[model samples]
Target: MACENMKRVQKEAINNWRDHLKRKLTGQSVGTKDWLSSIKQQQDFSRDDSIPPLTAPDGSVVTSHRGKAQVLAAHFSSKMTVPDPEREPPTVPVLTKASLGNITITTEEVLQQLQQAPAAGIASWGKRWQVTLAPDKIQAILISRRQDAVNWDQHAILLEGRKIHLQESVNILGVEFDSGLTYTSHVRKVAKDAAWKLSCIRLVAHLLDAQGFGTLYKSQVRYLMEYSPSHGPPAPVIPPPP
Candidate 1:
């Protein structure tokens, strides 16, 4: 009789445990630990990208016909420092008309010309090393024309929200004399109120030249002149190009 009673008690206890588990799984507020442990476990899996490269038995270092596979592996391993989602990129500074230091050109006049007649602005002011203005919403320059004699094509880098788009065809004097002049495909756009002034475009251009991209790509211009909000349009170029 005692054994039978013990069996019944065991069955009841098992049933109660199942019910408790069901409640917890359904989020019915049964006592449990914080959800952070699960989240942390997921994050750990996402961050880990460690891998080892193959080494030859001779230990003198191996090089393949396609270059060193181990070298490429090591490079990728070094880049594992930044995870896919853990790191956030550094913020970019705003640009303003006042930031255009030492540039005496009338920005208001340029802005007006861009709004009224886009083609005229490029023809009159979009020369080599000229600080041209454009709508903030425009990011990349759309090359409507290209010169046949020039070795380069039209493609200007955009500063995103900072610069006005001079999508109209314009020439960029190469960093080196041998590089020759190339037409800008499109200009990169930037924020009107960037943290780094647009006036620094020349310096940036030099850096890009050092990286060899300048020869292949157009460097963005920095408008360092101060921009008076009251003097010109106030709207932040919203509704960026689709």
Candidate 2:
């Protein structure tokens, strides 16, 4: 009977040690994940491709992979080309002090003038390559302090003879800018998106150890919040589960 009691005590001691080790490892894993997530939020600048494909100049939607690539290539090529020194530079209208004082300038008029100013340069470039600008893909945002200052309904910008309506917000690169220049909307959007992504990550948490989970969080959730071109509100902090 004494032998059996001694064996039982030994088994209990082993089980306790195993449990203690498991708990310690789990704590370490959690700490590592937290650290990785933090590092990712600071450094990651990756963003998902959510923007719609550009429409070609022919008025047909560029849906195919090759067509989309070609459109992007053409657009970027035109922007990157150097102006020829021998070629006469395109004339741009200069806004003089006298013109500004004499004219009863509304926001719409300013927008129109600015829109028209770029036409000469674009036309000169298009003449060389025989490539026309895609009006549908061009977007405009009117930045103003007053909410009613921009006449969105009345104001329309023309590019290559096609009229394009103004947008309340525009995403240039990965950053989003609204008409008011406030980043509240952008911050809210990033937070909501990160929350959704975290929920998805939770499903696969078992598949990944702490290190793996941390890496995933950095690449996906943290990246969305960190990459911004303009100064805005801080990203919403979401603490990891204890």
Question: TM-scores of all models?
Answer: 0.17, 0.46
What RMSD does model 1 have? 25.5
What residue pairs are clashing in model 2? none
Clashes of each: 51, 0
Alpha carbon lDDT at 163, candidate 2:
71
lDDT by residue for model 1 over 137-230, one digit each (tens)? 2332333243353322222222322334333343333111112234222222124334344445544666665444422222121111122212
Per lDDT, the best of the predicted structures is 2
RMSD of each: 25.5, 21.0
Evaluated at residue 131, the lDDT of candidate 2 is 85
CA lDDT, every model vs. true structure: 0.39, 0.66
Winning candidate number (TM-score): 2
